[model samples]
Target: MYQLTLGQRAQPTSPCGTSTDLRGGPIPAQPAHPTRTASSPARVGRRRCRPPPTDGYEGRLVGSGLSGCRGGGGGRGGDGSDCIDALGRLLTRILRHMASELNLEMRTDGYVRVRDLLKLNLQTFAKIPLKSHTVDEIKEAVRRDNKQRFGLLEEDGELLIRANQGHTVTTVTSESLLKPILSADEVSVCVHGTYRKNLDSILHQGLKRMARLHVHFSSGLPTDGGVISGMRQSVNILIYLDVSKALQDGMKLYISDNKVILTEGFDGIVPVKSPISRRHLSPSSIREAKP
Candidate 1:
C-alpha cells in the first residue's frame, strides 16, 4: 500500500566509506529529505553533508585543522563548510535545551548562561576578535554581557541585586524586608471603624484583652499608631484590627529578644555594640588642653 523512493530512504555515507544514519545507526534504505541527486558530482567528491537551517536563529561555525584532508582542496572546502553548518545546528539544539531546563524566558536581548554555554561547547562559535584568545577572555566577555543584560553584578564575587522584577517581585536578601519589624520595642496599635457601633465594640474588646497597654480607636484609620519609638529592651506590642461591612481584618502578634530601638520610623533588630564613654579630666587640665 506504501511506496518509498531509493533516494528518500538512502543512508548517508560516512567518512569511512560506510553508510551511516544521522544517529550513527545502520544505513536506512533511503535518505531523509535528500537535497542532492545520487549521481550529483558533489556526493562522489567526498564532501560532507550540511545540516538544514533552523528557523528564528542565526550563527556561524569554525572548524579546526582536523576538518581538512590531504589534497583536493575544493573538496575540503565543501566538507569544512558543511561541518560548520552541522555544528551550528547542534549549538542551536544546545541553546534550546538550556533555555528549557533553566526556566529561562528568552528575550531578543537576553542570552544563555556561561556555564550552560561551556557545557554545550558553544564557545567554539563565539567569534573572538583576535585569532588567538585565551579562555579567560571568552569567560569575561560572557560575564560582562550577561551582567549588562540582567542588571545584576557580582559584588565581592557574589551575585547581588536590589530587586529582580521578572515574573514576581524578588528581594536580594531577607534583611531588606524583615529588619524593620524585628528591631522594634514599643508598637502602637490603632483600630478604626466605619460606623459608631463597630468602633464601640472594637474599643470594648481592646479594653478587655489589653487593660495594661494603651489602645485607641476612631471613626477613621489611625495615623500615629504604626510608629515604633525609642525602645530600650523592646517590650511593647502593637495590634491593629479593622472591621467593616465589606471586609474582615486579620490579627497578628510579634515577639522580640533584644532591646528594640525605633528611630526615624524604621524598625530593626539592633545588635549591641561598645558604648562610647566621656573622658574624665580636671577643670584646670581641661582649660590647659583647650587650644
Candidate 2:
C-alpha cells in the first residue's frame, strides 16, 4: 500500500526531482562522489549508467512510455520500481473486486481495456492514493509481476489488458475454460500443496473453491515451475487431483496459459469428499500427523 508518485510535476526541483520515503519525508541526497579526472585509472574500464527515462523515452522504447508495445529485456522500462508496484496492486484490486463496474466483458482469457484501468480512481482502488498512470506504466507493471496475473494484447488494432486468471468476478470465456481435461492421463499428477495443519479438515471435507472462482493446482512443485500456482512455498501437504475420476464424476477443470491447473469444484462439491482420492505429504510430517 505504498504511495508511488511517478512523474512529479514540472516544477522547481532537482533534475531527477525528489523521491519520497514511506514517512512522506524527502529522501536525503547521496554524498557527492569525487569527480574523476581524464587520467584516473578507474575511468578506463567503467561503463556508464543510463539515467532514468525523462518523459518516458528510452533505449528500450516499445516497453517504455504509453505506447502499449512489447519488446525484450529483463522486464523493465527504466527506474520505475515505485510506479510499477503501484500499478500492479491497483490492477489486482480492480480485476478481482471491480472489473465489471466500468462496463467491460472480461473473460477467462483475462482481456480488458488498458485505458479503462488507467482511468480508475480511488473509488475503485479502495482510495489508495492513486495518481494518473500511463499505458506503458501499466504494461511495465504487468511485466514486472511476471506471475502473468495481468497481460496486454492487441485486438483489431486496439490494445487491451487483462488479469491472467484467479478471478473472483468477471466471467471468463476463454477456450481453455470451455474444454474439459481432454487428456486426463497427461495431467495425472496434478496436485495442490497446503500447510500440514489443514490436512485433517481437507481430508474430511475435501478441497473447496472457498472465496475464489476455482481451486488452483500445479503440474508439479515449484522446483518444476508448474505447481508454483501463486501458493506459499512452505506447504507440506500435497493434495493430488484424480483428474480422471474428477471428470468421470462430472467435474470441470481449466488450464491457464502459465500451465496452472484450475477447477471450480462441482455444485455441492464441497461437503462431498471423494471416497477414492490420492494425496501425499512430506515424509517429515507423516509421523507428526495422522496417516
Candidate 3:
C-alpha cells in the first residue's frame, strides 16, 4: 500500500551564468548547533547532555533508519509499528474466508466426512492467535458441531455420522446388525426393507453364505454362540433368508466354499466364499473371519 514520491524538477540554466546573477551564490555558513545558556541549578539537574553537532546530525541522532531504532527489532513496517498490526488483520481476513467456505460445504452436504473436513478446520485453527488450544481441541470442536448438525452417533463404539433422514450407509459397524440373524440356530433369511429389494436380497444371501454378510444397526448386533458365519462382524448385508428349510426338505447337500445362498424371491443368486460347510460349520469359524 506504500507508494514512492518524485522530487521537484529544476528549471533550465544558461550555459554561462555568473554568480550573484542568474546562477545561485554560495550561502553563508550557519551555526552548527543551537547555543545553550547557563541554566539555574534546578534546571541543570534535569538537563541531558546532547551529542556534538556534526554534518549528519539528523542521521546520528536517529541512529540507523531501520525499524531497530526504537526498542523493537526491525519489523515488517520497516520503521513503524503499524505493519505487524496490518499483517495480523490481513491473516485474520484470509482465515475467516476459508472458515466460511468450509462451513458452507458442511451445510450443503449435511454430513461431512471426518477426514475431508479436517483439512480446512485445521488451517483455520492454526491461525488462531492463542497457542493455548491445540489442533486436537479444534478437531473436537468440529466433531461436536458436526454431530449436532447431522445427528452423528456412535455405531459399535465407532463414530458413524449421518444426516437427518439420510440413507443408512454401510460402515465398519455394519457387522453388529447381523446379531439377530446369527442368533437363530435355524437358518434365517434377512431382507432389506428399503430400496433395491431384489438386489439387496441376492447380495445379502450370497454375501451371507460367503461369510460376507455384515450389517450395521443403531444398537449393536448380538454375538452369541451358534451365529452364522459372515453375520458376526461389520458388513453391508441387509436381509437374511432362513434356508434351514432347504436342509430339512431333504435336499442333497453338496457344500463347498463356492456355494451360494438363494432365496425364493430373487431370480438369480450371487457367488460367495464360505470358510466352512455344513460338516464343520460353527459360529466360531464365521466370527474369526475378517470382514
Candidate 4:
C-alpha cells in the first residue's frame, strides 16, 4: 500500500510533490523533455484510463492517473468529457483500492467524505494538479457513471462517496459493507459472468473469489430491465447459482447498494452443483455443469 503523505504540513519535494512507490520507496525523477515554443500550444490531452482486463482480478489495476494534456489538446480539465472521464476513473481507484493507502478514513460501509477526498494532492501523469476538483464535479461523475459503481450520500452536512461493490480492502467486511439476503426466496436469479476462455478453469476448480472478498453475481442478465452492475456488459458466459440451495446449506450471500449479489462461498470456492447451470448469452442456450 502506497502512502502519499496527506494533510497541509506535507510539502512537495519534486516536480509534482514527494510521491512514494507502492512499496513506500522514493520515486526517481523523470528526465526532462524538450520544451515547446509558446507559439505551438502543447498538444497533450489527459491520458485516458484503461478498462479492467477480461480475466478481471488477475489483471493489473487500471485508471490510476490522468495523463497530462494542455490547451485545446489533451490535458486535465482541457476537454470537458475527458476531464470527467478521468475524474470518474480516479474516484473508482481511490474508493475501491486506495482509501487506506491514502489515509482517507473510510466508513465500514466503505464511504469516504467528499471533503476529505478533495484534500488529497492528486495529479495527472503529466503532473497536472487535481486538488482543485469541486464537489459538484464528483457528483457529476457519479451521475454519469453507467455501471452505477458509486454510491453518494449526505450525512449531516457532509457529502460521502463509496464504490458500490468490488472492494479489495481488508478493513471492509461483508457483514459491514453489504445487505444480507436472509431468505433464499429474496434472490430469484444469481448469475456470475466470465469470459468463455476462463470457462474450463472455472468448471474444474469452481468460482474463486480471487483477490476480492467475495464472488460477485448479478440478479439478472445484461439485457434484463433494471439490471446495471455486477456483470460486465461484454461477458459471453454466465454461471447461474442456486442461491436458495446455497442459502439452505448455510452459505451466506449478500447484496450491495448497487444490487450486486455477493458470497464469500464455502471455503472461498463455489463448487459445481447439480442445481447450478451454465448459459451462453443467447436465450436458446443453457446447460448444467457436472456436479
Q: How do the residues 1-291 of candidate 1 rate in per-residue lDDT, one tens digit apiece? A: 001000001122343323543212233243243474553322211113442232211211133332211111222233334333323333333332234444533433223333333332122221111213333333333233311112233545533221111111121122321223321133332221122223234233322222111112221112223322211111111122222210221122221111121111112211111221222333223212210
- Report, for all candidates in order, the number of backbone clashes: 10, 3, 17, 9
**Residue 53 shift from truth in candidate 1, angstroms:** 18
Question: Highest lDDT among the candidates is held by which one?
Answer: 4
What lDDT does each candidate get? Answer: 0.24, 0.50, 0.25, 0.63
Off by over 4 Å in 4: 1-79, 124-128, 274-291
Error of 3 at 49 (Å): 86
lDDT of 4 by residue, 156-197 (tens): 988999988888777778888899998867876787766656
Candidate 4 backbone clash number: 9
lDDT of 3 by residue, 109-203 (tens): 22333333323322111112222222333233334331121234444544432332111232212222211222324333222211122333433
**lDDT of model 3 at residue 273?**
28
True lDDT of residue 287, candidate 2: 27
Over the full model, what C-alpha lDDT does candidate 1 score relative to the true structure?
0.24
Question: lDDT of model 4 at residue 4?
Answer: 12
Task: Indicate the residue-level lDDT of 135 in model 4.
Answer: 78
lDDT for model 2: 0.50
- Candidate 2 Cα misplacement greater than 4 A, ranges: 1-78, 101-109, 123-131, 173-179, 226-230, 268-291
TM-scores for the candidates: 0.18, 0.61, 0.17, 0.69
Report per-prediction Cα RMSD to one decimal.
29.5, 15.9, 34.1, 14.3
Task: Flag clash pairs in model 1.
Answer: 8-31, 9-29, 9-30, 9-31, 10-30, 10-31, 180-267, 183-268, 183-269, 234-260
